[model samples]
Target: MPSEQPDGRGVPSPSQVDVVVGGIKGMLLDGTLGPGQRLPVEADLARALGVSRGPLREGVRALSHLGVLETRQGAGTYVTALDPALLLAPVSFLAELQQPASPALHEVRRLLETEAAALAARHAGPQALAAVQEALDAVAGPGAVDPQVFVEADVRFHRALAQASGNPVLAALVQAFAGPAVRARSRAAVGDEGALARTVQEHRAVLEAVRAGDPDRARRRMGAHLPAVEDPLAGAGEDPDAGPS
Candidate 1:
């Protein structure tokens, strides 16, 4: 494996193996590494990242766990299908890390979800519309202030709406970002006051625009709804305590 120690020249550490792996992972996340594209030969990658073959292999294995790449006999490694569900496996792993600090996943989630919400408004079908209404009803009906139940409904609501966008990959991305604490913190931030009430209204706006088949309106409405959730994260510097729950 590549040494984790820094080189005498004070180069960016001798952890070239991790560097290679992280480089490849970053490429995948940024869409530079697409599914079905073969990776360069081990020697080539090693030279590029200034690492040896041993650490390179370890890096590949780590990304494989995230479903980001695959190796074939004699054919070498290739990027896996750029499916959202596949991409999200690492999210469960990341979730464990969140309990220790404020989760940064919400930022990623907000990006995907806001996009999904906009798309759902444009592409929603009768069934999709029904799902949105059901979720909204769950929030509005009696005994709605229960945070846990409301949180569950909220997840279902956003997820269902994302799926309605007719994009499975996008839906998966949304789910990965929408971690439990992020949801809970959002609820807590808004509390049982007008914030919750505003959420219902925003969701309704998204649904109504979708029902009307107005993609632009849907997108705008969805975009409008995100500020309230995002504001706190902006002030909190990404890991600020969600405060007790």
Candidate 2:
């Protein structure tokens, strides 16, 4: 580690760290490092960048969290293969944690998912369609899987459906919102067997619409599937008394 300067002046500069991380990330973007190639030694890196060890390690840790670098205990750190989706997981977490004060998120999900399901109906290859079916099957049982399990499977279903739409952006967008929202909704719906049954039925309807290649039906079914949960901000909201199924 480089010596810490109390006044925080000079020595291992923060801006210098930024520059080094940016350079390395650029190399990652350009495929210069190539996946699995061992990074140069820490001493080698400091020498190459003309910086002290402190900032160099900090930059490496930051990149590691970004999923652009992998560190092995005895071996060496290396550039990751840089899968775009893997790198975006933190982005998804941030998106999910954004303001939930309004039902705007439900609206967003409704808009994206309607279009995604419709496109999936038309463009889904056989394999993608099968993946959707598998997810549907996993969640088909009468009882909701543990809230966490159900949320995860629900994400897989939506993500697979979004992928079937043939749009990576759509998939990523859906992945971002669905995880947090599913966790919330599943928790709200747990032990509410009626709601669980209704959810399953709605999913089945969406699946059928997709299977029939009827985009209009798919879109409508998706829209109908959005439940009006207890949103105090938006009216008294739909009565909890209403049976879910």
Candidate 3:
């Protein structure tokens, strides 16, 4: 069969699925395919890759899941936009799958955010600063807000902070690391009476530092703020010292 890779042992050397995947990836790397470009017909691609339809389809599906391909009904499969944010979505999912109290994820978040805050302090314009303020206002708004609502605003604030850094790559990295942390923070907020208030206070501090155009202060404030968010989740069903399980 075209899908079988014959070895000396008379066994398949590699799965057809992998062959298809690797072939497409090679096409991508060599510029035979490109972002937003339509791929050849499925049959054509299968023949070109020396694989059968089944394995080619499976490989396409897997690449689609990785945000590397897009299938449009009636048109055919095409390369995705391949934006960094879109490509990093799977990394976000992987981060979300980690333990709720994972310190490693928090460490990554801290590293990305601290640098983002520093950049934001240097680069943020009035509109970006306003966006940050709006996010902060949503979280610290009057009356009682739902924990989920607070979490959403909290995420928006940090994302805005990242965007203000004027670096798309840094923003995407921050977003990828923040997804799971936000979920964990939401859960922690539900149980911890003072979590929301403390979050507002911390966000305010970071915003103030960013607004003042003090890069060092902004970096320090963000570094401090992220760990504070993790404090409530420290002992939640996992050993804080142990790595992600």
lDDT of each: 0.70, 0.73, 0.84
Q: Judged by TM-score relative to the true structure, which candidate is superior, 1 or 3?
A: 3
What are the per-residue Cα lDDT tens digits for candidate 1 across 106-174? Answer: 556656776786687667788888987898788876544777666777777787888898999888766
Candidate 3 lDDT, 1-245, residue by residue in tens: 23667799887687889988899999999999999999999889999999999989999999998899999999999999888898888788888788764878888888899999999999999999999999999968778888778888988999999999999889999998987787677777878777777778778878888899999888877776676557764433332223322
Q: Compared to the true structure, candidate 3 yields what TM-score?
A: 0.81
Query: After superposition, which runs of candidate 1 have C-alpha atoms over 4 Å from their true positions?
Result: 1-64, 68-83, 91-110, 180-184, 189-191, 231-245
**Candidate number with greatest lDDT:** 3
- Candidate with the larger TM-score of 1 and 2: 2
* RMSD score of candidate 3 (Å): 5.8
> Could you arrange the candidates by lDDT from highest to lowest?
3, 2, 1
Candidate 2: TM-score? 0.72
Give the residue spans of candidate 3 off by over 4 A.
Answer: 1-6, 9-13, 190-194, 233-245
Model 3: colliding residue pairs: none
Best by TM-score: 3
Q: CA shift at 80, candidate 1, in angstroms?
A: 9.4
